[model samples]
Target: MGWLWDNAVTLATIVMAAAAVAALVYAHLSITENRAAERRANANELWRERS
Candidate 1:
């Protein structure tokens, strides 16, 4: 734990990088899920229109 205090800057930089990566991954997954939901809604609308 003393090493962490001694290398606080380095540790913080690593933590920030990890957080950025996690954010990007979460954003990508959200976008993908939203697109899938949009597609299903569109398909349902089209079917209703035809029926």
Candidate 2:
């Protein structure tokens, strides 16, 4: 078990990789939300005309 505890560089690399993956996941969610909002606005405008 000491071998696993001895590699600081490997542990740092794994942490950085995990953070990068989390950032990508958040970005994907943001794009999806923005797209849905735009579609909802368009749909509302079409149905909102009083004339």
Candidate 1 structure quality by residue, lDDT tens digits, 1-51: 899899999989999999999999999999999999999999999999999
Candidate 1 global lDDT: 0.98
Candidate 2 lDDT by residue in tens digits, 1-51: 898789988999999999999999999999999999999998889889753
Best by lDDT: 1
Which candidate number maximizes TM-score? 1
TM-scores, each model vs. reference: 0.92, 0.81
Question: Runs in model 2 with CA error above 4 Å?
Answer: 1-5
Model 1, residue 23: distance off in Å is 0.3
Clashes of each: 0, 0
lDDT of 2: 0.94
lDDT, residue 47, model 2? 81
* Number of residue pairs clashing in candidate 1, backbone atoms closer than 3 angstroms, sequence gap of 3 or more or interchain: 0
